[model samples]
Each structure stands twice: as C-alpha cells, then as structure tokens.
Target: MAENNDLASGDDILASYHLPSPKPLWLNAVYARHIVRGNFMALSARPPTVDMGEWVAHQVVEHWRMLVTFIRLVHDKDETGHTICNGRTCPKMSAGPNHSFTWLNSRLEPVEIPAYEYLSLVQRYISTKIDDAAVFPNDPTGVSFAPYPGASSSPSSPPNSGGGSGPDWVGRRSGFPQNFLDVCQKIFRQMFRVYAHLYWSHFEDPLYHLGLEKSVNSCFSHFILTATTLDLLGPADLEPMQALVDLWAANGTFPQDSRAYGYANLRAGERLLALAGATTAV
Candidate 1:
C-alpha cells in the first residue's frame, strides 16, 4: 500500500481511499472471482513470506497484455469492407463528444491526435513503464523501476532506493514507493480510456457484429472491479463511463456501496443516454 504523505494515520488513508468488497460479476463471475479477487486478497493479506507486490505486478502485467489484445482485436476487426477503427474514421481519441483525450509528446506537452495513434501511444507508454527495470524490478537480476524524475529533490516526496524488488515488487526496500501507485494508476487510467472509446464509438458495429459485447462487458466489469477494489482508479477517473457503472451497480455487478459506483457529478443524464444507446442488454 502507498504511504500517506501528510503523516496521516492508517485509518485516515483507509477512509480517503477505501477498499470496498468485490461484488459477484454477472459476466465471467468465475474468472473474476478466481483470478481478480483472489489476487487482491493475497495482496491485502501481505503474507510474511511472500512478495505480494511482485505477485500483483505479474497479474497486472498479464491483465494489460490480455486487455491490449482485446482492444487490438476491435481495432483490427472487419465489418463489411474497411476496418472498424482507423485514423480517418476515428479522428480524435474520444470516448464521447464530451470526453476527448490528448497525448503528451516528447516535450511533455499535450497534443491532440487521432484515436488509433492515441491508443498506439498508450500501448507504447505502458510497455515502456513495465519494461523499465526501475519500476518493475527483476528479482533474479536485481534492477529496479524508475522513481519520480526529481523525487529526491522534493521535500514532500519520500526518497527511493534504486534496488530491484524482483519482477513484481516495486522495490526491494522496506517500504513501497508512492511512485508505484502513481505509475499503476496512470496505466489503468489509459486502459480505461481504451474501453471507453470502444464502448462509445464501436459498440454496434464491431462489438455487436463480432458478438463480443458480452466479452467486453465481462472483461471491463472485471477490470473495474479489480481497479476500484485496489484504489487504482477513482471517481473522477471513471467519469467517462459513469452511466454503465451505475447500470452495473443497479444490477449487482458492483456493490451498491462501492466507491467505483454512482459518483456522477458531471452530466449524468447525458451519460445515461449514452449508455442506453450503446446497449440495453447489459
């Protein structure tokens, strides 16, 4: 778990980012329970002998690999003639008319790009982060993941030891770096964007046509469950697909009390309409 910066008590941190119980998923319940939920429990338990973070890193890496394949399947999907997703058809990286994403260039400035380009960048970004030995250290070889660029110079941030924590462990040191949470959060956020883009833009064509609606629902629902339960994502991050989350909560795919559900301060009605138009089957 990431430590609190303000020297806040453990209870304070818990209250700030609570871990809600996992609700049984309507789609792929068995997989979600056995794979996602089981891993989370193991992490939370923090067994004395096991390197829990390393185990979690492996699971997260595998999940991203699967998610990348799933999204690529949609991108490469064929309908009648042309491909489902392309630069000309999807001009912007957008979940809806309301939510548009911009990419950071080499200079670290946000730049508008085409959807395909944006997703490609996202894939590259995740790959770079995971492969960075500083962030995902190799235990046997002992190279660590990167810390924040100027983490040591900053007074508020904690210092990071450059030691490797094996494959999944963020660090081999006594405490986990706050930067690990930051990196994982960013990764999950980008992944969420892909799911949002697929549901909003390509649901009817490739998703429905290819009969992948349930698969997407199953995967995304499990994704949401895992991400939220572990606090990798927050209410603001989930704003793009708020309506579908609400629908899931109503139907019990997510717990009613889960922080991942029912936090739509943004245009709730518009999102509901978007969800309704996307699919009523869920």
Candidate 2:
C-alpha cells in the first residue's frame, strides 16, 4: 500500500518532534499547527455549534486515515529484503502475552487471526464504514439528525452528548444520529487495538528501527487526548497500553487538567502485573 503524501519521512518526523524550529512532520498541517501552538485543548474541545458525536465522527475518520498511512511504514522491507511485518512475524493478533484480540465475523463469532490479517481487516472495516453514507452521512447540511428508533429517553445518557455537563453551552449541541456515539466507539476501539499491537509487538522494528518512535508517539498522544476528550474510547479499551499512556501523561504530553490526563493516571499497575504474570506462567 502506498503511504499518504501528508506523511513525512523519518528524518522529518524526528525533526518535527524534537524541533529546533519547524512544524511537526508527524502530523498534517492542521494538527501540527494546533500542537505547535500549544492549543490542543482548544482543538480538542467540541465546538458549540457542532454535535459532540458529529465532531467525534469526523475526528475518528481523520485519525483512522492518518494512522493507516503511518503504519504502512512497518511493511517496508528490511536488509534481508523481507517484509518487516507479516503473519509469520506475528502469528497471533495480540498486544502482548496478556491481551489477544479476535475478529468478529459476519456471524458475530470471534475468530482468532494473525496480527497482519487482523490489522488488514480493521483497515478494510473502517474504510467500509467511512464509505457508508448511512453510517457517516456525506452532507449533513440541511438534514436534521434524529434519535435512533427506540433510543433510551434517560437524561443520564443523552444521545449526542456523551453524558456530561460541561460549560453550560458545550454539551447541548445536537445534529448527529443517536447511534453515532456507539458507532464511533466501536471504530475507535478497533483502532486502539491496532495501536496496542504496534506498541507491544512492533515497537522495536520499523518504529525505533526507522527513527519513527517519537513521530508515532506524538500521533498516538494526540489520538489518545482527542479520543478520551470525546469519550470515544473507554478505559478497558486502553488497558493494553496503559503504562505508555501514563508515562506520556507524566511527561506533560497530555494536559494535567484534561480528561485524557485523568484517564492516563488510572490503574495501569494491575494490568502490567497481569501481563507479567501471564508471561511467567508461560
């Protein structure tokens, strides 16, 4: 697969993250601009006129696109002229010894697959969702969004608002279908699995090997902050890489006052111990 033109090379990515002075090559112009300006909070904040679900939907699609581009670099050939990432190298879809993911087929039955295949399926699944007009409307201009049929009337869980009372004006916007939140949740969860696998299984090869670690870290940090800000991903979904998240948060990659930072501080020790135990058992 061809990489996105928006993505920069390893040297550029390194320069961007450790900048002596230049835009971060890790992100596209828009994202780089916000992070460079130190205004990711404002960028992550849902606009008053836009529904939270709608805003998240847009971001999820964008993040998926960019991440796919970034990850393709892993497939580049090594000095042996062999693919760096493939089913032979990663026979199971696992983040580590403790967390192995399975694909849900058309029948909704979980089926284990190789990491390479699982990631491919995810890319195709997200691509299909992005192309589905019913899932993500092409032009939602004049079309008013409605609550999904039989949606709960519980004020505790508003369809568009991901259940929170922010500044009086913030969470009240509405225009997205009630199901958008749930749909985006699934999308992001799958994407997070890909990140977990990358961090656990391929961090050394391709990423550190190509000097793309900082670049990938910067992108993942932005993704974590944005996804958590909108509540697209739950804590359980992030458990596999919670340790890395915590480290980034401690280093100020995420603002201390933000929801993302709070999430990063949540229970990572237990998960790490579990992983260690699993390894020891084997």
Clashing pairs in 2: none
The number of the candidate with the highest lDDT is 2
lDDT (tens digit, per residue) of candidate 1 on 1-282: 123253654234323432232311221222111212222222222223334344346556866986886677656546665556777879999876568899988999999898888887888899998898777766564423335433321112233444555333333343345477667778888999998888777766666677666667767876776677556677778866754565555344554444444442213223333433432223
TM-score (C-alpha) between model 1 and the true structure: 0.64
RMSD per candidate (Å) reads 11.1, 13.5
Pairs that clash in candidate 1: 54-168, 54-169, 133-144, 133-145, 134-144, 134-145, 134-146, 135-145, 135-146, 139-166
Candidate 1: deviation at residue 224, Å?
A: 1.0
Which stretches of candidate 2 lie above 4 Å from their native place?
Answer: 1-39, 75-82, 143-176, 266-282
* Tens digit per residue, CA lDDT, model 2, 1-282: 011233444343223223223321222221111223253566676555444445666688778976886567665456887665687888988876678999988899999988878877888888898888766776656333324544332222445444466532212344444466666778888988888788777766666677666666767777887777776776667767655554444344567777666765423322322323321110
Score candidate 2 by lDDT. 0.60
Instruction: Please give each candidate's TM-score.
Output: 0.64, 0.68
User: Over the full model, what C-alpha lDDT does candidate 1 score relative to the true structure?
Assistant: 0.57
The weakest ten consecutive residues by lDDT in model 1 span 23-32
